[model samples]
Target: MPTQVIQAQPSTNAFSGFIQFWKDVKAVAQPYWYPNDSGDRAFSDVIRSWGMLFLLVLLIIALVSANLFNSFITRYLLDIIIEEKNPSKFSDTLVLFGLALVLVTLLSGFSKLLRKKIALDWYQWLNNKILSKYLNSRAYYKINFQSNIDNPDQRLSQEIEPIASNALSLSANLLEKILEMAGFLIILWSISQSVALILVTYTVIGNLIAVFLTQELNKINREELEAKADYTYCLTHLRTHAESVAFFRGEKQESNIIDRRFSNLIKNAKRKIDWEKNNEIFNRGYQAVIQIFPYIVFGPLQIKGEIDFGEISQASICCYFFANALGDLINEFGNSGRFSSYVERLSEFSDALKSVTKQPENVSTIKTVEENHLAFESVTLQTPNYEQVIVENLSLSVQPGEGLLIVGPSGRGKSSLLRAIAGLWNAGTGRLVRPPLEEVLFLPQRPYIILGTLREQLLYPNTNRQITDAELKDFLQQVNLQNLLSRVDGFDTEVPWENILSVGEQQRLAFARLLVTRPSFTILDEATSALDLKNEGSLYQQLQETKTTFISVGHRESLFDYHQWVLELSQDSSWQLVTVQDYRNKNTSITKTTGNTQLKIDSFLKDKFQTKLENSIGEGLSHKEMNALTSYSLSTIRSKASKGESITTNDGFIYRYNKDPKVLKWVMD
Candidate 1:
């Protein structure tokens, strides 16, 4: 999960760098400020935002002016105390100084408060904007394959707020410090232009150093952000696959994986620390040397009686404020590396969202058409990357109220075909005709457990369906999960259904959903694989009872009883669709792995399909005899009986049997 570091180009041109910086800034900020294309953000909102910002600007100006005024007042108060030494005069000037301090404090606090308020508002709008694109056009899913943009969840959840908040902080700090620097420079100018010019030269040199150092900080900040994302994602991956790890007893392997990521994070943290240390040393040294500028220029003047001692004191205060203001500006510039890092990241994320969400123009992809029935017309499905063809030049259709089962050898695109039908994969040339997605329900092997009440679990994909308590209980009973209600508080109770229920139980619960919503067309992807034949048959019976047109992907021959037709996909990309009976007979020929010859499975089962005519008895059939008679191998019979399914023998020696110790059972067709 560790993201690859993108090195900053050290020789990047100044003009080109400014151009890129402006593009990143505009991409991130313009949508919030401009009403056009921001459908959700209104013009009135824009006006109000600009108005608040204007007030904030005024507040900053007022705050800086108050600081300058107080500096002069402190000088006057000192002159009175030192020269006049009269308590009455000093008391009046001291009161004036105290009032000035109060003004400065109020202005400073209000400005900061306003700045935060504006920043928060911008964050709200930008989060929603990015979130919309992330969810739109399945970008949330598609963005994962894009390796360049890592940890979108981290970006959306953590990085987004910083863009708005830091942009405001950077601007406000830059504005306030610049104002202070300018005001102090004017104060110093009145005293001596030569001294003011010297200080200006120092400020210019300091800015040049900050610019160079900030570039290095930019690289460090970027790596730190990426490393943190990688570390956080590793922890999340462990949580998700905790069960798999426990099953394999892979704690050591998992620990090593996490440790590797942690080491990278720690390494990046160390580099950042080193950079901060060097930057801090430079900052302190720069400030230490600037402290004596006033003494160098005006200390001799005060001794010569050219100016009052008070003027000397005022000059030193002005120099301190001036240097401190310039230092704050330089510090902010250095910190802009972090700001620019965030800006570039957020801008790239936004652009990537836009790119992935956009529907490709004039691209060759499968076109989906909504209709009352399901069909594929000359549909050739390819993997999303177009790297390999799943099935080529294929055509098939499922009639209304009919069931179609897709079967194939392992890795023959059986599941991929279903994905194409569901509109999840549509990379190849095709026209897929199916019912509207809302009317279709897809149940995969692993049922998705939404975070909500038990009722929501059953009523998923359509939670608003009003099913009475009695009706819900009936649905549960139909799936043989009536006992589920006893274990829970009620149908409305919320629990982590996944961990609370076993795989078989989860599958049955998914069938319970089929009963609740009863979608017009259901597509199941080995939905009942975890369940035994008895449970699987029970669910499929309910599925047939619902009379919904369904397509199922599974390897079990028991699925033959539920579906009307079988669409077998061969490894060579050839396909054949026929009745379930014909498919059962035909499949024995399709696979040569077992043997050269195939038993006519239907010919053997058709004559002995009956199980209710009489109860099975005796040592029904020997393993070899049964394989010869019913074309059902001993392994198949053992597999069937292990799951406790009813057995029918072809010899008419036994009809149906369960727990009959003498009989070797095989499930009936």
Candidate 2:
């Protein structure tokens, strides 16, 4: 299989392209991301985990109470040491404080462990659902066709995990934060009345900055996905034509292409880095301000006997609660930005698929043909780019058990006509009355070679439409492709046949396939062009024996003999359909006797130009006249002239010529 080299086509316009891309993504994600069944499940899981969240709340209360109790115990111990206060009471208080701290730490660990388990389960469930949706309804092919969006391969591969993973983790973290806020807010508010207000204000300020920075990062992430897909597309395209690149020595140029795409990616990444850096700077300063401000407001009160040391500790615990709640807000904001973008991308993919699958108006799928012959009633086909009709109002018919050689100059719609009949091309007018579609087989110029062994190639299209291996091998031998059997590892060998065999070999294999399938009529569109003359002759001979009616499109003059009728498409876009008998006249230039004495020379010229001669002679001649003319033999004419006379001249002896040439030669002599 020789690869055809093609330079990169123009980049689809960025603005228009991205708009469509975004639209497709939006369509895909809309139903999934909307608070529907899956969203409900996600919501339920977050709710279900609230039992552990409540336990976490209790753990926070215990930890805060234990610290306050420990502070009191410390003061009692100081009194005992300095003022001879009761030692037994002090020792008992210290023991209680240590036990409470241990119990609270264990409870918090258990809460964290339970929340983690629930988060992961939800993530897996949601991701599988998204994957299933993406796979259904031929969405993949429709997406590929309808949009210029790059690398759906990445959308399926990379984007999905992050979408599900981050979503689940963020949701779980927010839930825990809400519970933490509940546990701490009351205690902190009771302990430090006005200081609690300052904690809330600072938390709001810090989180707002984090949220804004994260939103910017989310934008960068979306752009990164697009950039990565673009880079992947180039690499895949390069792989598809690796041989062409090697032949053209384009490694350096391709490297530059890859490098330029990556550089754009790097710039986006740098912007994300800068945003994160600024965000961290604000976060650290805000965190320092919150940590010290809580202590500073409570410290003076405790010193002035306005509040106990235990009360100051409780205020610090309350600050932790409010901070945790604000953290949830920041976490939700970050994930909301990213998840929204994912939703947008997936939605666009789904919408484009829906639009594409809406079959064109008036496009009929010919399910069953109820006739003996296929007829194209004044069919006209137009090229998409050219907007010019390749075939116009061309009515043609092929009856059962009869054949036609569709002859035309290159690019004159011979193959296009077949494609229209096959129902692959829709830009055509006129009803093609087809007998059951299964009855017609079209072997294109370059036949498709699926990845399989020789046996699989023959058995394709009949996938499990069981045919014996022996019979398939026999068909292969008939097409002179028996050599393939030895080359193959075995009948079931799984190799890429398109790469393994040459195009000519593949066409021959297509013939083998045809023999097994044995449709009522076959159309060969230059199917034999790559084969040498002998194989072409043999294959056509096989078709004749099989009595398989065929419509062949080719410029090879040799095919004219195999077909009984030729339909030559004219430059004026008219069709001249004629039988072989119409080309039988013997007086045309093609029929003029040559003076080449060599046997091979005469045989070769006659074989090569015989069809042209027949056609030239038949153009204006009646079928009966043309037949009567070929029926007049050179042997019979020579025999009759020998019987009459030979007149000798200085140059040579002459037999009967035309009446005019005879008299004039005699007068000159």
What lDDT score is found at residue 166 in candidate 1? 82
At residue 186, give the lDDT of candidate 1: 90
Q: How far is each candidate from the true structure, as Cα RMSD in Å?
A: 5.5, 12.6
True lDDT of residue 37, candidate 1 = 86
Q: Which residue window of length 10 is worst by lDDT in model 1?
A: 610-619
Against the hidden true structure, what lDDT does model 1 obtain? 0.79
Q: What is each predicted model's overall lDDT from 0 to 1?
A: 0.79, 0.63
Per-residue lDDT tens digits for candidate 1, residues 1-669, read: 112234345336888877788888988888878655857578899999999999999998899989988878877888888788989989998898989988988998899899999999999989998899889877787666433687788789988888888888888888998899889889889988998898789867986887788888878777888898898998998898888989999999989988999999999989989989998998788776667777777778877867776776677778778877776777777777667777888887877777655555655788899999999999988876667788888888888889999998999898898778777678889799988888989899998889999899989978898889999999999999999988889988998777789888988999999888888899999998999777887788889888899999998777877889999888888888899878756654454225655434465453453332232242343344455545355555555555555444445443332455644443233
* Clash count, one per candidate: 0, 18
lDDT of 2 by residue, 399-451 (tens): 76677888778878788777666755546566677766678787989998776
